[model samples]
Target: MTISALDLAAETKRLLTELGVSADRYIGGTLRVTSPVNGNEIGVLKEHSALEAKDAIEAAHQAFLEWRAVPAPKRGELVRLLGEELRAAKAALGRLVSIEVGKITSEGLGEVQEMIDICDFAVGLSRQLYGLTIATERSEHRMMESWHPLGVVGIISAFNFPVAVWSWNAALALVCGNSTVWKPSEKTPLTALAVQALFEKALKRFVAESGAAPANLSTLLIGGRDVGEALVDHPKVPLVSATGSTAMGRVVGPRLSQRFARSILELGGNNAAVICPTADLDLTLRGVAFSAMGTAGQRCTTLRRLFVHESVYDKLVPRLKTAYGSVSIGNPLETGTLVGPLIDKQAFTNMQSALEQARAAGGKVTGGERVENGAGDAFYVRPALVEMPAQTGPVEHETFAPILYVMKYTDFDQVLELHNAVPQGLSSSIFTNDMREAETFVSARGSDCGIANVNLGPSGAEIGGAFGGEKETGGGRESGSDAWKAYMRRATNTVNYGKTLPLAQGVRFDVE
Candidate 1:
């Protein structure tokens, strides 16, 4: 297959410039591309531009025809080239992620690495993206099924793990042959820009490496919720993918259904980690800390609810307090800072509400405090642990903060029930040495989530494992060989060649 940029000159910067965008806060004044984590002010974003939104959709629609028309192999080639570029920019991208989202330096760097993996996986797995061929009852008839990319895909990404999640859509969209319009969370636009810039550079190389068509076929539109809503409802946009809250999913899911378009809705999770009496308390606590505090517990898959076996509940609480206490809290840019501020002012507000609500519900706050004084400029908060009979907190209603709720459960069935109580079913974990209990949880409650692990944190998503919540996690599957296939429609070609072929027609009659 031939590979080339849709147009070599059609780089993201070129297009943005032609669209009359200035480097200085390109879209508007309300949306500044400031680093949410480190406080660097070097990026550009469209705060809320109806015009930019319209332009992005129009551009994606134009690119859609050619991108969708491109052969799958050629698309894969471009994605492969982009992956190479991602690898090269790891250091810079890591810094950008840290600056933009306040991700711990290591975790921030890890996001770029993960994105690279996704790119490589998406590109290399093109062969698996296929359809089924079946023989018909009649000698002359045959049947085929294939995957096809929906037109312009609109991806609305959250602030946390900006690089990783953005690639989830762009790489898959390109590999499946669909033009994409990326609307990153306004709070962390820098990471998205850095990732995209690197991707385009790779695409340019891809076009030169293999002569085909323009490879930079995707465009990014940054703005607030209003901008996202515009993209979702756009007539030209046929596919929508959102990584956000259950409430956002509730609103967006119904809206897309009305249009009869495909939507990959990965919503929030009140994820749980069940710690058994026989497991390693230290290890389990350490692992759960990844989700409860990682990225300040802002991810859709953060470990919000922790269920402990009655035998270990008392022992684990203080251990958790000490372990969580060790996290260094400060500016994201500060060297060795363990935690950064929440994504933005709104996220800070959400965390505060969760704390207040948890206290109202008779939950005890063992540790954790709010930093940054409620100012939107730098919304930072310490990791929180609330002791609750149930997983109750501001998070119960959807706080999405850096807080963990500890619940004590004595029964296996009750643990399963507690885990499944949330509307979301994205990620969950179990800390257990008892093989039987682990087996039961895996068998009985496995259907409730996309990824379930034993002795692991809910936040650490595996590239090899399939991720998609049952109810709101989107009907589509991604992150592996199956991802490309989901973006494509399958088709099969049947040939008779005049050779003797068995038909089911006579066989069916005989069976009857």
Candidate 2:
């Protein structure tokens, strides 16, 4: 059933009550949440204070002490239950995510599905947190490495992917025997509360069936910079996983490093796609359209830059313009709407400002005008296209919006340089039928991104691979592969069974 806006609001209130999180729970200040869909006031949240944030950290740390001893397989079972809870609440929580974070209905549900998928993945990963066994130099000595859980894990997520990012970190962290304390984006606190409530429900069920002490394995702190800073600087939080802009990563990366704590930062992506002359234009058009405009182009992996072979540059730009004109822009909850409003006026302003700069820098910009249909100051704009003479100027950096900057390339090396020119290198793709070109793009000297693709756009990463990037994009992986290892510490053990005290390199020491 398609939930009405009124029903969603009521569901949110009920969820807040059930979760024991409302305006009264926070003392910092009131956060009035306005829906970007139609500029309506959805709800208000109480911002958490520093003391409350510290208390949450303490709770997660205390929980970690027992959680680490629960055995990895048992932890996986709990994650399985969390997946079930997410499955049960998928629609409602997905709808809440849409309402709170300006995601369209389908994208919202997909985000929830991502959470469920990660839970399932983490459950499987519980038993597979493998360590390496080493060959010993001595005859009677065996050496191996064991993985132990890190203490408290701190997660700071962005508004664009409020729930999924948290689950990506928390699910693996939990299965790896670490408790989590999350500080979700203040703009999307309701979704965080809803997810936390569901997680707590799953935790309760696990304890009931297993007869284990109910540890507060997961915690949510709803607030702004104060709470986030507290979480990042807390001595107990040995690892902090953050997902946001490069500027934010610059701040978070240094803070975590100063304390010698590990940080998994999934930061910004000025992702690009290079279209060769021999590329499949039809498929390339579809892939680029979604990559450039999906979620109104707010995705970190969104294809913000396009490098087209000069031979097909003339053929592609017009088709891209036609595609842009067909994109449906309206209320995100509506049936056929594809492009939703920006997160707020600031995002809209960013889009406009970026376009203006593009125009001033010898670039031709089409679309990007504000839509003033009956939505009442809600920020909406047509997905923009900027034809640039070179990859310099405004196209050099990332502006989180549906703006695609197209540049023509003459040579393969030039195209690769254009693709790698941007500072952020999260995801990159090249469309070509030539095997040599395809192989070259994926080679060590080609794309410098963490993810590289052939005949595909630079978005929609699967959960199986480690997702992150190089340089300013924050070289931290999350959401699959051996990313679970980040949540644990490794200790090498040596066993000597033959009862002889020996020193390395045949150096012997005798003590009385």
Candidate 3:
């Protein structure tokens, strides 16, 4: 059973109000907000037009001028305050994530926790934005490089991780001394509004504690493709961090490149896992279960394909099938519910179409049936486990649902080939206790994904490591490590203390 539209709307309003968003602020527009958990119309948001999006970019650019001059540690204080606000309202914000995006209770809270984690990470990174000091060839010369803030950072986020992705970019962008303009997914605008409200509270606290902060330090543009285009094409926005499908990246990547602006594109992932003969069956079962079925398999790192050694394929497939049979699918807000509804009916149709194609390709599919929740329009589905003869056909494409395609492999070398065969290079993993196999999997020649792991699933990437992928995944990194460099510009400087005017490399200039 699912919550009624009226109840869901009431709860949504309550959460928003608690988070400091007024009713008139987000409502009174044609942009309808629907809850994926029960297919209920939660509310309506006034969508920003393309013109407003451009204006937002200009405003953020102006804010960047002032924010860039502030001390990095002072900028970090704002992020710290934002982290406190997120922690205080984590429960309400987490529930709002579930209400808007259909993530399970734990995952919903986990998303907010991710935001808080990035803020903590950014707070420390402010003082650590170190530059390099190079040893110069010339006598009495000092050469060094320093990083300075870039202009407006435009962030276009996807629905699966509605709020966390924005925080990933915004937090780092803030610490790096750049202002941010966010274009959240149209389907999940309410969470963005709530987050913006929380950010505003953090900003007020920041100003009270510190001296001043720019007016548009972080701007939220709630709209569809046109708004995203305005952000992408805006000349002032020097960096754009986009997280969505590869097709979206194909459009966004070149558009930024054409204008010589920077882009951090976190695109699609047809992630896979290899189960070796020496792998722990229990651990592999659990890893595969959560990686493929978690978030209804909507995550970018969702395990879409699996390659198992012929020695253990028989042992693991049955266990995986049993696990899939027991997943509880219902409203995401309900505790103990491991799985939740798909984002919409379109996602359900996509899953069915992929299953049909798998069948036509001589694949035997189990599960992938729809569950009847009391809410007629909500889509709850059984996660499908399909056994295929080869890694071809629909298996190569990411269906954005809980469908795991399993194939058998005899050799470790051959399995690696099958693993990197897909166009995506986001995340991959191998479950093996063998030290050589594990080392080889992460070695230069192994799994050609940005993230490769041994005895771990491809999903649930931590924020400490720079997150992104290569090839069609867009070659962009975000959240952690030196990713803050992408939001700032670098300058190399050389100073000569010697009085003599000497030319380097033994070059001589003669004057008459």
Candidate 4:
């Protein structure tokens, strides 16, 4: 059932009560959650102390000592139970995601579904963490590689995808027998709490059924910059998975590197799509519209730039303008609403500033003005379309708003260069009916983004494929397709029989 605003408040209160959290305990130090839908206060939460952050890391470290001893497939059974818990709480938690993160109802539910899907993927991967065997120079020696679980995994997620990103790392990290400490976005702590509550529920049942499992296998640290820094600087956290803006990744990537630790960073994406002359306009229209506007263009994979062949530029531009005009911008929980309010006033201001900058730079921009008709000061705005004469100024970087920049390209070579010119390489797509064109786009000489597509939008990546990007996007992989390897360390081993002191490369120094 779709959750309404009235029911959401009551449900949140009930959930807090059931989780043993009381507002009276928070007192003066509390975070007041205001609904972006109507600018009303949702709930106030007590932030975690900095010392508590250290305690959580120590707990995860203790858990890892026991967790890594559990067999791989047995760890899978625990994840399977967690998946079942997510399925049961999908509606209520999804509703919380919608209200807190400003996603439309469907997108909110879809994010929860991503959590469930990754759990399923991790369950299957438990038995499939394969290693490679190598040929040895000596006849009596056998050489092979084995995978061992790393210590604690620290996850820092962004507000755009409150729950799914955490699950992507947590599920794989858990199945690899590594405990995790998650620090979700300060803007969306309630969803994090809700998810932690559900995980504990599943963990309790699993322990009862399977004897003793590791305590504090998963933990939550809810606070702002100080708490996040505590996790990042902690010595026990060997692998830190962070998802946020490029500026944030620039800081996190180096800090983790300084300690010679591992980090998986899913940073900002200024993705684009190319529409060829041989493309199906009907299919192209839907792909471009959704990728450009989905999540109010807040996703890391949102389509920010569009390169259209000159032949169809006239036809596609007008259709796109109409589509942008027709999009319904209002409360995300309302039925049939396509575009929701910006996460806050600053997001609205950023959109406005970008539009103004485009106009000042002599680019023809349509739409993108604030929508004052919605809830009182709710920060709603129309998604924009800008026809740029050149890819200069604000069009070159991402503004984290519903602004799609359109440019015309005369040749395929020029289109490819334009598509790859941006610094961030997270996702890219092409719409073409020509087989050769599609093949070339997927080839090594083609798109440089981590994810490449044909006749499809760049947003909404599936869980089965490894999700990450190259270059400034951090060069880290997550989700599936052997991403589990990142959660473990590899060691090569050699065993010898037949009483021969055979050295590698047939060394003769041993004869002395």
Candidate 5:
């Protein structure tokens, strides 16, 4: 069963209204918002121009100056309230995510849960923004390093994990005493609007309960590349945390660097998983299936490549094929549907192009045929499982679709080499029961990706760990650990209490 355009639109309108977004405020505009489930126009938004984006950045900068003076715990209070607001509207917002991004119901809710989790994490982080005291050589001298909020934070998010990625940065940035300006993907602006509306509610409550709060703490810029570029190039925006394609990163990174601005780029990933001879076939199958096919393989951490030991290769491949054949693909909102439609016709076209290249590279492909759901213009397809001779061009490059390239390896050492050969390194996993193999896979010389799992697949990452990648995936981290430091600036200080000048390395310069 598929959702009709009218039903989808009605559902979207209801969700938005429930989340405090009035229809007349955002529904009439030149930019059309559509659901990937049926390719139906869900809403319309007036795109923010480049000038408006710059004004938003300036407003965020001014808000940051005031917000930074607030006590750290007080800043945390606002995030705590935001968490409450997100919890209250999780269902409405999660469904909006599913409608906009084509995520399954569970995945959609999981994304909102991520937002709430990050808010909780940031609330805790607010009081724990620690500074370090260094030992001084000179008598009666003290040295330390402190953190202060950077100006405005610019966030550029993609369509796949629309709301979650923004929260990862915004929550941390807020706790760090920085204001944010967000530019969501053109494909999924409604979710951004919904999130901002919820945030506004949280802010209002915070102001009523607390003494003061910045009204422009979080601003949304809805537009295309031009608006995003304005955010990246703005001098007031000292840091820009962007999540999108490597191609987008290639442009964003340089533009920021030209101004010496900081960037946390969450780019593309060609993730892979290795299966050992001692691996539990049942556990490995479940891990591989969800990681490869979940969210239609649009996750940055989606497992796109698989390496199985020759001993278990023949056994696992057939089981995987059967599993792929049994997967239910249809409307994402429907229960029991494991796979949802790709974001649009372009995504379908890209998937087909990658499959053709895989075939030319001597691959045995199974599935990947388009499914004829009743929804008009929705692009649903069966996930493809390909047995490849080697890691060819198509296998190495990241394709945002449900295509898993499988290969067999006789030696562990050689397989590790093949795993790290790709240009993009985001997430990787190895399924092995052997203690030595498991340790080796996660060891210093193990999977080269930023996130390496012993028995788990790489798709779902928790908020407690720093998330990102190396190489072309952009060597930037977000979500947890010391990721909050990226949103602030550091300063070193030396104070002398005695009437003597202090010098480092036993070298002193005395002013005459």
Candidate 6:
């Protein structure tokens, strides 16, 4: 149920020490966690320790040789077990995520459940994986391409979504038959360890008890930034995957490229929600709220920008303001909290700077409040609304805050133009009642993003959908059929049937 960060940390540290893991001093007298509901700081251990860099790699490398041989079906079974453990640990992980990452309990639970769903879906998807056979004209040759593993995969996840992002990499990579070395967000290693425990137990249940899994199928490394860097750059890691801001993605992407390693970087999103003239006012307002404020607007898929047609801007803005006026705040673990604090002071500062930038750039600030800290004191900046930019400022940059920007658009082409203005096009939306405009956006301008929402709320981006973006959105999509393919290396096997001679075609082999 609901618990304080201090209590959770005390219990967790006790658990870690008993398990032979070392806990480090949490910096700033804060546990590196702030309530999204109020930005309250959790004064607990900020750092975590486990195996060293070499050990992390060796574990992953060892797991790979044996894991790669397991059939896909067995992989599915392991994932299934992983989902169950996640479910069993739901309440604990949810509160842990809330404190460490500044997500409200609802948002934290959403992430926990979504990760569980992703693991379950990934498990079953293994049954449909098959090779493709093709006929070549070269001397009647038949060629087939089968997918294979890329050995050890290293996934570096972000603090914003410690569980979902990790599962995004682990589920696909594992089900595709690759062992992984995971480094969770350094700031929120608590939940990651719980997740790792679940995975460890699941791997044992599916692979060992079933008498089919390899001896070492997976491993987790809980440490600092250096640990993450070491995990990714290790020569033994054949592939690398990261989900975070674009700046960090740049650093890792190049290193992987230099090493000739396969890499996938699902970076940032300045996602937008554009309400067309034909959009339903009531429906559109609700959709914008969900997109704009979901997960305290920390998701890469969160709707950060809102472009409403002048046709409906006047009708929508004030109504949205009215709806927001009643928006709940404070206490993430409380039953009725609507919005939470920024992940931490850094996030709060970023939000404050961005809000001021927007205001200096001629945007208006609606409301700004401070979140309550653990000692029942204020910690983070509350949800805020910035008026449309007369020009443009940090809105172009990915500002992961509960603060959202509202812009007024007048023309059909302008709606698309404004939506495309975002350089980091991770996910965007077009709220319209017309199927024609929605289809056109989906077919034409829609290709720019990894996730595009139409009619649906922006945060409702599906897990089974194709999600990869053009330009700064990073390479190779995660979540969907595309994800499965990205985890594989294709090998073409060809056999010549030999050309049939005219005499051979007319004669029987037995000469009966």
**Which of the two, 2 or 4, has more lDDT?**
4
Q: What is the lDDT of residue 170 in candidate 6?
A: 84
What is the lDDT for 447 in model 1? 31
Q: What would the TM-score be for candidate 6 when compared with the true structure? A: 0.88
lDDT tens string, model 4, 290-357? Answer: 99998898999999999999999999999999999998887788789898878888888889899989
Residue 312 lDDT, candidate 6, scale 0-100: 76
Deviating ranges (above 4 Å) for candidate 5: 508-512
lDDT of 5 by residue, 1-512 (tens): 33654478888988999998888756779899889988888998898899998888888888998999999999999999999999999999999999999999999999999999999999999989999999988889888999998878899999998999999999999989999999999999999989999899989999999988877999999999899889999889889999999999999999999999999999999999999999999999999999999999899999999999999998999999999999999888888989999999999999999999999999999999999867768899999999999999799899999999999999999999999999999999999999999999889898899999988899899999999999999999999999988988999999989997666788868887
TM-score of each model, paired residue for residue = 0.86, 0.96, 0.99, 0.96, 0.99, 0.88
Question: For residues 91-143, what per-residue lDDT tens digits would candidate 1 score against the true structure?
Answer: 76676577667677788788888888887877766656656776566666667
Ten residues in sequence with the least summed lDDT for candidate 6: 34-43
Model 1 worst lDDT run, 10 consecutive residues:
1-10
True lDDT of residue 336, candidate 5? 95
Candidate 5 weakest lDDT stretch, 10 residues: 1-10
For residues 329-444, what per-residue lDDT tens digits would candidate 2 score against the true structure? 87787778888878988888888888888988888988888877676647888999999988887798889999999988899998898789888889999999999999999999
Off by over 4 Å in 3: 1-6
Greater lDDT among 1 and 5 belongs to 5
Ten contiguous residues minimizing lDDT sum, candidate 4: 1-10
Per-residue C-alpha lDDT of model 3 across residues 261-301, encoded as one tens digit per residue: 99999998999999999999999998999999999999999
Q: Give the TM-score of candidate 1.
A: 0.86
Q: Quote the lDDT for 25 in model 2.
A: 45
Alpha carbon lDDT at 435, candidate 1: 93
**Model 2: which ten-residue window has the lowest total lDDT?**
1-10
Model 3 score (lDDT): 0.93
User: Which stretches in model 2 have alpha-carbon errors above 4 Å?
Assistant: 1-29
Report how far residue 474 has shifted in candidate 4, in Å.
1.1
Give the per-residue lDDT digits (tens) of candidate 6, residues 308-334. 778777888888887666777656666
